[model samples]
Target chain A: MSAALFLIALSAVLALGLGVYAGRGREMGLEQWSVGSRGFGAVLVFLLLAGEIYTTFTFLGASGFSYGLGAPAYYILAYGTLAYVISYFILPPVWSYAKKHSLVSQPDFFAAKFDSPALGVLVALVDIVALIPYLVLQFTGLGIIVQIAGYGAISKDVAIIIGALVVTAYVIVSGIRGSALTAIVKDGLIIVVVVFMGIYLPVHYYGGIGAMFATLDHAKPGFLAFPASGQSVSWFVSTVLLTCLGFFMWPHSFAACFSAKNRSVFRKNAILLPIYQLVLLFVFFVGFAAVLQVPGLKGAATNMALLKISVAAFPPWMVGIIGATGVLTALVPGSLIMMSASTLFARNLVGFVRPHASNAQTVMVAKFTVPVVALVAVYFTIQGSSTIVALLLMGYNFVTQLFPALVASLMKRNPVSKQGAFAGIFVGVGTVVFLTLTHQTIGTLIPGLPEMIRDLNVGIIALGLNLIVMVAVSAMTPKTAMLPAE
Target chain B: MKNIRLLAILPFIGMLAGPILHNGVEPYILGMPFILGWVVVWILITSAVMAVIYKYDPANAEGDEP
Candidate 1:
């Protein structure tokens, strides 16, 4: 095998070995498997939470986004810092509540908070739908990275299949502990690889980072800043805000909070996480470097921009190292997502059906479902042709629909009834699905709207509809007994 | 003491205002487009602001651990 492919294979074996070893000699109950039995201290919790930030999505999608859309890609950096700020306040209460209630999944938190098992089931369904696309994005990135680094000796389909099997093997056995252990290595490798490529490519190609921007501005005017309309200032502001609200709404991120040993872990992390987000600036530099060097990549093909430029610029061993980092990026997040989705399925959906199912039985069902989730994501990764960023945004639209109800439930009085929360999520998710299926944006839906309002992210409309429905339903429905505040 | 938490809102304002007030390619900040530079600065500002809030917030006071 080539040096690059050999490196990738070696790293894959290393990740599998570390992941399985995390579960060695430990009891594997649902709580232990899903949330590390709520025992993770500051460092492990930090790695796990930060792990969500540097996924294949950031490794590949962020760079590709800058390469394709330029200024709009800055939203990636903007929303995450804002999300960390939001998480500072929100996650402490969430972690405390989860600790008290012994909640493992996002649906478990909602179910206990609202005192409604059906709402939990509804949330599980919505989360599964949202998470599938995200998992598919990781698999798609893995496919592209491995295929490119292997010099195209392997097909993308085969690469995805192998990646899915490896992730499934670890997650089914080791669960969240596996993801946390692998995250340490993934984060270390990605930081080094992203920073090196980000700085090296710019200096090598255009003498300095400043000179690179000067050359880009002269070659493609207005590409580095938002346009007046379409993906405009309005779109940038709205997209950033919407994604910020939705960031922790991803079930894996929500559940990851439950793993923290104490409430202060989140507060401390909130201060540090934004600095971590600055690492994404390096990711954008890599994308910007690719834009001028490897030109003419359009549509979904743009997702390959980072890898393409790497292949053109670096020798086989260096490409292999980058590929190895990419593989771990996908596996770390991919396993977490698969684990979360399966836990939601078995614990929330199936447990609702069989309300008396024992904890061991629930864990068993979850273990069995990991490969099934991997299979479904693999199928979609092969069939879907959307750019990696587009897939994530689509998932964000659906998942963000859950945010209004989530925040409302955390209120001191929780003005929203369980019925209201259910009605709101149903309508919000329904609106997203309807608009997405019809390929209709707010601008297209309501003709003659002003450009500023029209170009706003369409997810905002769904969120607005969710808030309205939740309020109306809450007013009409009798309030359920509120959970006693701490 | 309670009002200290409001410091977190600064990042939202600074980051969201980038496109509206400073969206441009010219006058690059540290070799980045104006909007990109605006975001990078705000990220640093956010970290600093949160650090201050963490220092003063009553929630983090000793013996507050649950």
Candidate 2:
């Protein structure tokens, strides 16, 4: 069943990627390819904005957290909605700033703001590296979506790997437009699926959302609360902070935000995106339903809970559509990840490394990187259970170092030191690696903090430390302030 | 500036409303709780904010049409 669905999804991805890239060849130039000629409408803006939010992590990780944590999973809803509203004001100012200066990537903004390519490159590197594990989750999602649908007997790994390769080919060929067009279908389909499931799931599984949570709460008290069973307040605080801070850090967010013709759309999307989050109120139930009904497999089956529960509940065709949408969710964002990664390689890394490369030459180098990284994403999805949301937050933590630098650079004083910016990132990454490897998750990963404050949620903690060091060091340092505005 | 000030309040309102509504605190007005009422209010506020931003035509935003 999963295999059949897998093949159909693979074709949709093929059509989506090739279709967009083919619509307007790379002639749109780097800027156009990356940002859709900077004239996207309300519809494209809406789809791209929504697509940036609804990644594989939204499906697998949010629900998985719900599966494990129960009601407090509402934090996913809280954070998701909170993210949109915050963006309303923050993004408009950023959009205004970007327009005033023609900022391309988040790194470009940081670089111009700090008056240092080194700082730009520093954040750029963080953006690219942080996105890798996240990209892997998306492909792994495709793989699992395929495997469950039993798509004509193709193995899940094969289905996922194939889907990723096809998307990569067109992303390489077309650049950003390729990814954006496909996002339209993927984002649209998921919204439809979510709306259907949101209303239907509770009715089918637990009489209503109220009843569902009520049943789960009575059966398992800790699951319904924010501080999950055996979890502490410190962990909850840190995790919510990590998730919130991570919002702007995601690569897809950077790509979509940069492409906006003006900040107004960014502001509008910011205000409206919470409505999408409201649509996601279903995720809490999806996860809780899995915990109550689905056969549990430790953390092994967490990623599959969505598909398993969906397939187990609906008819096969609806399963096929949901499965296809899930694959689309993975592929749509996955394409953006690779697309952004490629652009960074061509325009940022190589351009930084080579310094005098032509735009054509840079694009060539980026086109080459597309497939190689897609292959790496394939490797992770195939061999692993796919760390969906966990990986994205880890990416978020790394990106937050740039936030201080990001906000600082745009304003009068980019009071963040490039050296300190790098230092904070180094410490942030070190915290994630040390904590994650030591078998202790931050917040929910470890189930408790105080046990490891320095361990999990390193991004927020390190970012604070980074700010302290950057400001103190900047005070002692020269006052050249890299102000890049009107 | 007045509109912008009102706009800023929207986010704080959203943040406050999030945890409360999704916790499934469904008190019906006629049938819908203060929560659903809040959501309707949120949508209204968001529209108003957008309308304000559009109408204000902040000097920086005039040349740009996103």
- Report interface Cα RMSD per prediction: 1.0, 5.5
Error of 1 at A118 (Å): 1.0
> Which prediction has the highest DockQ against the true structure?
1
Model 2: CAPRI class? incorrect
Model 1 regions lying over 4 Å from their true place:
A387-391, B62-64
Tens-digit lDDT track for model 1 on A22-140? Answer: 99989999999999999898999999999989998888888988999999999989999999999998898888888888899999988988999999999999999889988998998
Candidate 1's TM-score? 0.98
Worst 10 residues of 2 chain A by lDDT: A225-234
Which ten contiguous residues of candidate 1 chain A have the minimum total lDDT? Answer: A385-394
Best by TM-score: 1
Off by over 4 Å in 2: A1-7, A10-14, A17-22, A25-28, A96-102, A228-234, A385-391, A417-420, A430-432, A438-458, A481-484, B6-66
- If candidate 1 were superposed on the true structure by all CA atoms, what would the RMSD be? 1.2
Candidate with top lDDT is: 1
